[model samples]
Target: MLIVAIILSLIFGSLGFIVTINNAKYLLSGYNTMSEADRAKMDIAGYLRFFKRFHIFLSVTLLAGVLLLYLFNHNWASSYMVLYPLLAYAYLLAKGNTFYRGTSGQKSGTYIGIAILLVVIIAVGSGMFTSLKNSEIVVTESQLEIRGAYGIKIPKADLTNVSVVKQLPAISIKTNGFAAGDYAKGSFRTTEGRKVKLFVNKEAPPFLLLNTREDEIYYSSDEVSSNDLYKKIKKWQKE
Candidate 1:
């Protein structure tokens, strides 16, 4: 997952720089909105230089963060990696309005609003990611416990069926939760018209199906071997 994230960051970051270099006019659409005298006084070249430097800084910081994750897997470093770029980009956006549009700092309320919105978004997004990433399932003799966001604990006595399957049926509806790429960690409805809870990392193979008195749950883990998990659960159920 870290490798995939790093590769995607490198690809997108490089593409942003390429587009900025090749298509400056596309981003400076507001140039025409300026007064004639303001437009004449605009240092178009200087604006482009500022953007180039900003892009480079952003790209390098991301790459560095990726490398740090690859090497150490530090949580603080990971958070810093995400936080710093957003803060830097926010600063750039505020500064750009003044530099490119001749807007005074006091008049850049839109920029300030956007920066605040971005900060809120980053905080919420980071919190969600952390919650999902920390999700885990624990099977005990009396109960199966799911830990993390959208979690629940089911008593073994209430479960009617517990088994492992090679694949899951199609999902009909996501009653709640988030699904991105290969990660599906939340509540969903199966194609068979059953409500299911999912805490899965990869959707493809090796899943556990739990049928309780009221609901069916589907889950898998990236950190543990599926066969080992199945054996553990079966043993716990017998106890």
Candidate 2:
């Protein structure tokens, strides 16, 4: 049930993004006086373009974020997943439809008012209510094992090792830009030699504390990153 809910939430989020994106374009076209078909295409193409640029990161983060939510609590992920679509919907409304404004030189989408109204209704109807619930995150001193996707752990020993290695990060530095993304850039790999980007570390080794990519990265075609692996570290220090 939980898995199914996660997948469905993803689908809903994707579709919701599409709907709101198109709606925005349509509305903007109305304000800008774009043709019906041109407006429709812009409505979609804009989101598509934006998604393509960030899709690489968004898909990984959202999926991992939701799945990891399962570790904290059963519906924790599901509850947040529900907001994905709502968020996308609200984005278009907020981004506005057109660049042109009224004669007063105040440029705003003519239909934004309507979109905001709908967002308010849909956001509430879609279960936007979440009782502020406080929960503690249990982690180990050496390594905390999260019982979810990769079930990764951050061992105190490894953190110490990384710290120790940090004194001589040159050992972890590679010659080329293979580690280009820096701390900000995280990665996941697949059995088929395919690689995906990620933000969370789910593949750190106990003794490998510094944020160096595993001598050999953790690979899996499925949807998983080592959860605790940090490929992020100082460059020249490693150099």
Pick by TM-score: which candidate is best?
Answer: 1
**Mind giving the per-residue lDDT tens digits that candidate 2 earns over 1-239?**
35655575466446535544435545433434654544444435554455444434445556776777767754456555555545554554455444222232232443555567676756544432322121111244434333322234444344322231211122232222112101212344434554433222222222223322333222211132222333322221233
On the 0 to 100 scale, the lDDT of residue 73 in model 2 is 54
Task: Report the number of backbone clashes for model 1.
Answer: 0
Clashes of 2: 25
Clash numbers, per candidate: 0, 25
Distance (Å) between predicted and true CA of 58, model 1? Answer: 13
Q: What is the lDDT of residue 103 in candidate 1?
A: 44
Clashing pairs in 1: none
The per-model lDDT (C-alpha) reads 0.68, 0.39
Give TM-scores for every candidate, taking all chains together and pairing residue i with residue i: 0.57, 0.32
